[model samples]
Target chain A: MKRRTRKAFISLIIAIAAFAILAIELYPIAITVINGFRRDIVILSGQPFKLSQLTLRSYQMVLKNIGFQLGMKNSIIIGLLSTGISVLIGAMASYGIARFRFSWRNGLAYSFLVFRMLPQISLVIALYLMFSYVGIRDTIGGITLAHTSFNVPYVIWLLLPFFTAVDKAYEEAAMVDGCNRYGVFFRIFLPIVAPGLVVAAVFAFLNSWNEFLYALILTGVNAKTAPIAINGLLGGETLTWGQACAAGTLMLVPVFFFTLGMQKFLIRGITAGGVKG
Target chain B: MSSRKPDTDGVSVSLIKGKARHRAPFLFLLPALLVVFAVLIFPIVFSFFVSGFNWPLSEGAGTRKFVGLGNYLALSVDPEFWNSLKLQLGFIFIAIPIELLFGFAAALLLNREFFGARLVRSLLLLPVFFLPILSGMTWRFMLQPRYGPLNALLLKLGAPEITWLGRPVTAYAAIIVQDIWRMWPFMFMLLYAGLTSIPQELNEAAEIDGAGFWLKLRSITIPMLTPTIMTAVLLRIIDALRVFSEVYVMTEGGPGSSTTLFSLYTHRQAFGYQKVGMASAMAIFLLCISIAFALTLVRKNMSLDSLEEKAGGG
Candidate 1:
């Protein structure tokens, strides 16, 4: 009976702690969403948690902003293009490393790992100089190229295990049945590893979409992404808290829903990183 | 099964197979290698070359003059560089353990079967998906001394309204809080995965031996989770060292240079002060640190693999 009571007390504490964590995690997001709908910044100042006179004025203003729209377009283009290129090339390389034994295969695999671990800021300066010299500095294509540089290695790392785990017997049987290597990869191997591809693509898209440093350095106006656009709202003469919050919501909502839908895959992808090769 | 087993036919077939085998891998790797070379490898080499020169963004590459080791030498004596390095180290040391503690606790609590476990787990990961700049902006607004919700809560509780981002220490604390809030979920997710991956038999065996929760956690759970913990810590440290956007958005590395992290400092040197050579030197310095950490991680991974093999064998 004493032990049962002690267990109950401990459980209560755990429950409280979990509740606190939830509040801490969700509070700022809640405030952001609420402030986005609020028309009066003064009311936010007075009563942040109060629900009074909410409107879509801030959202209307942010959505109509040309810079915001351009940023959205650029972000989508960069995200999708970079993700596609990264997954395609990375899957090929991962397949090579997984299927073919070569003298430098281990070295190539580790190099990809190292590249994936590299800090973006470390490479941003040189990339800026190089891209400008090549006359692609402020273009969306240039930013996509930069994003793919990191994402490809990431994709390779994530997909290597997936490809390695695939049964070689299937590929061999296909080849023996008169299917060429390319045909086997497309028709059999690719279909088998579709889940890994989806996970890699999702990560690549999110990473590119959320990336700021490369986008900030490489693009000036024409190719600025959404994160940069939202950051721009934080600066300058006026502090448009309402509009900025609205913009933040716009930037966050899609990713949030996407993440919610892909939570299972995301969890697996994350845990897969911890798995020993 | 065939005449191919004879010497002449077997030799020719083996040679063709060998050639094809060698060529196939390279064919598969070509596109990725080309992209890596053009984007990552070439830029690194270019950066190293540029770092050797006193290059300025304002000046064209042609007009720039070489100043070999001048920037590195300057960086060695630069107080701001040292300060930034110190800040980075401090941030890592302080933030990582706290994150681990919070994450471990959360993981422990959530590892149990619960009604809202799935919903809570998904909600916990929300911060990980938040755009850093937006999160920073939200926190920046929320941490305001007068109008911020936090201070408002303090006032309601009859506590003095302390300036959250007004001073150096509090400002730095705010940065740490923002980062921890954004990142603790990652650590939690990884640790939770690690916790869940431990076989139930081990814990049951420990319980059968009259072990309590703490004993089981210490002897069985932690030992099993070491690799995951190490991976999580290394990744977090590398990430913590490169923290830029949060600082850029939150404090802008100041009431002074109090919170000037390495990446933010590099940004200031490169863009704010137009010291490309100096900034490139700093970037290389950071790259060196990352490489060192990567090497350590590789070494740890190897040792852990051996340990696992030994455990499995035994």
Candidate 2:
């Protein structure tokens, strides 16, 4: 009887805790998702949870917004461009650090580490002023350039483990198997560490994709990301939760896919810091 | 394996191979370096130069009036600047230790092999991927005094619905709660990851010696996790120092500047008040704090790995 009572008490506590967690997280998501389908938030203000009060109108309106579409295109283009450049550089840098000895290797690696420490928020204003001065402020190329500064260091750090763990013999075996350096790297080393490269690329893409502070300061209509565009519009009376929710959900799509069924890999990449990649 | 050792007959082969190896890396690094230099590094140096002169990005404001350390001097005397620094320090003081403690508690609970462990761990990661601005806005909606579910629940439970972000202490308290909620996941993630890496053999040995749960945890679990704890704590410290996006999204340094952190102060100085020189000085100070903490972490991480290797070899 005593043991049964103890189990009941524990289970009750667990249930309560679980409910609270759901209230904090899923409740907001639920509210937002429901509103995303509502024609206007005023209808929901009367009855917030009625399924009959829904419409696809907000999503339609949001999709029709040229700013949203353009922001989406720019994000994808910049994210892909930045990721590709950063990954290629990251692979090489990590390879260099892991496989070779140089006098200033530590210095080079340390420089990259500093970039991770210095998130965009720290130098955002500085970058804004400088970029605007140089006449590159509202261009996609300018955003990409700004992204590469942070992305390169991130890629190098992320890819370091896979490069280090990859046995040198793979390249040697390829070399002795009658291939030159480029041939060995492409044919052997690259394939062996493909997952690490993917991890680095994904992180770079995500960072650039969802980055907002710089986008807010640097870009107006010319280079705004979805987050900035969405947040800018979420204001004042008629702060239609429906419209904001629709935009927010749309912004979440790419990130969702990127994180989908890959939390373990993503988690490993971050905490492992490629130490165990 | 044909003469694979670097120290044996492979010395010259290794030297040539090593030198040749770096060729690929340098080539690989070139594009990234060029882009980074143009965008990031140049701006850092350029910003330093601009900080000394009273200039805005826009040309119509003024031709660069050289102020010669006036910004630094002004920043030191700015009451708002000092208040902002105090706020950031307070956040660091209040946020980090709470996060660590709460995170450690959650990690300890989750570390046990429970039925729903994977689900629980994933639940923790949800906030990590959440955009900071989104996090603030979402929490703001929840804590709204009138129609907010939080208040609704409070009223139902017989407690008066307290305005969380309307007043000073409660407003700052809201930030603390939000920050802790968003950040505890990180500490848990790191500590949990670190906890698993600790060999079970140590635990078994401790068990053989009759250590209870508390004793085993107090001795075995903690010491091993210290380095990782430091790493996570340092990351949090650096991050907390630059707390801007969330606060901006939530309050915009509001309630008469009650929530203004250092970065917010810098933003207000440069943009709101047009104190470019003073803003730059504050930026430099923020840079110093970040650098001091980050450098210590990086240095410690390098030494820890080396020490681990030495211990492994011995």
lDDT of 1 by residue, B235-311 (tens): 78877877888788888899789888999999988888788888888888899899788767755664222322443
* All DockQ scores: 0.47, 0.34
Full-model lDDT for every candidate? 0.81, 0.72
Best by lDDT: 1
Model 2 TM-score, all chains together: 0.89
Q: Quick one: best TM-score, which candidate?
A: 1
TM-score of 1: 0.91
What clash pairs does model 1 have? none
Error of 2 at A262 (Å): 2.0
